[model samples]
Target: MQLLFAAPARKPLQVDRHLRRQIVRYLTTCFEILSPAAEELIPDELEQWGQLRIGNGGDEIHARGYHKLRPDGRDAAFVRYELMVDQEADNPSVDERLEPESQYGELQHIFVLTIPPKTPKVNPHRKKKRHLLLAQIYEAPFKFDEADKYKVIWYKGKLGTGEVVDALTIQCVIDAGEYLYPYIPMFDSIL
Candidate 1:
C-alpha cells in the first residue's frame, strides 16, 4: 500500500511587491475600458496587487517561451526564472536610436499573477482566466555598449533599493537566461 503520509516539497523563497503609483497607472493605460467594472477592478488607488503578494513562491504558472519558470512543465534542461526584454515584440528600431542598451533591464523573481475566476453563481458569463506575469527589473545604471544599443543581451545590473517588483509589461519580455552564469562571449546568451 502507498504511504499515508508524505513530506511536502521545499518552499521557494518569495519577494513581496510594493507596487508604486506609476506601475499601477500603466496597467490602466494598457487595457483602457473606462467602465465602472474596470474602475472597480483597477481603481487609481489600487496600490496592492492581490493583497501584497509575495514573490513567485511555490505558485507557478506558465509564461510563453519560458516554461522553466512554470511549476508544472517539461522540455527544460533546467527551470530558469530569468527573463529578458523581448526585442521582437517591442519597437527595436525606435529604441535603437533613442534608448541605451542597458536600459532594457533584467527581470528576476518572475511569477504569474492570475485573477481568480468568479464563482459562477451570478456571473456565469465569465470566459477564460486572466494571467499577468510580473517581475522586478534590474538595470545596469553604469554599463553601456555603443554597438549593442537597444539590443543588449548581457550586462551586470543592480536592483534599486526601493524598486517596485510588479512594474513589468507583457510586450517587454522575450525569453529566459541563466542568472549569475559566467560571462560568455556570445551576445545572444543574455536570455
Candidate 2:
C-alpha cells in the first residue's frame, strides 16, 4: 500500500522577545555611558535609538543606526544593531569612504550588535533559533593604500557579550582615549 501526505507548512518568523529585551538593555547602557545628558535633552532621538525591527532573511537586521558623542564631549560614534546571517559579506562594508582622509583629526567608532544567522531546523521535531554573536566595535581611520579613504581598526572583540558591563567598559576606554588626546576630529565631524 502507498501512503500520500502533504508537506508541513512553514511557520512565520517570530520576534524573540528575550533577545529584544537584551538589545534594549544593551543600547540603554551604551547611551547612558556615551551621553547620559543627551538622553533627557533628546528623548526623541534616544527613542529612535531603541527601535528594533526584523529584516528580510539572508543576514540583515532592520534597525536604524544611532549617533552620539563620546563621554569626552569631543568624539562621536555610530551605534548599530543588526541581525546578520553567518555568510560572509552580509554585514555592511567599511571599505567605502565616508569622508576625506585629510579632513579628520580622530577616527570615528562604529559599534555594531551582530546577531548570527539562525540555525536550520533539519529535524522535523527541532526548531530554528537565533543568538547574538558578538558586538563588533571598530574605528574608521584614514588609509592611503585602499580605494576608500578610511580603514577599519577593530577593538579586539570588545563588547563580545553584548552586555551592559562591556558597553560601559568600552565607553570608559573611548572617553579615556579622548581625554588623553583631545581635539581629535572624526570623519563624521568633518562631514
The numbered model that scores best in TM-score is 1
Instruction: Put down candidate 1 lDDT per residue, 1-191, tens digits, no spaces.
Output: 11111222133323233433323443454455333433344322221121111233321223222223434322111112223445554665554233212233434334334444561321233675555444434443333355854544444444343222343331233233455664311132223
TM-score of each: 0.34, 0.21
Q: Supply the global lDDT for candidate 1.
A: 0.33
For 1-191, candidate 2 gives per-residue lDDT tens digits of 11111221132222244334444555454334333322222211111121121222211111112334434454323332222223433456544333212211111211223322331221122343322222223332322223456532222212232222222122112211232332332222111
Per-prediction backbone clash count: 1, 2
Query: Each model's C-alpha lDDT?
Result: 0.33, 0.27
Worst 10 residues of 2 by lDDT: 42-51
lDDT (0-100) at residue 180 of candidate 1? 61
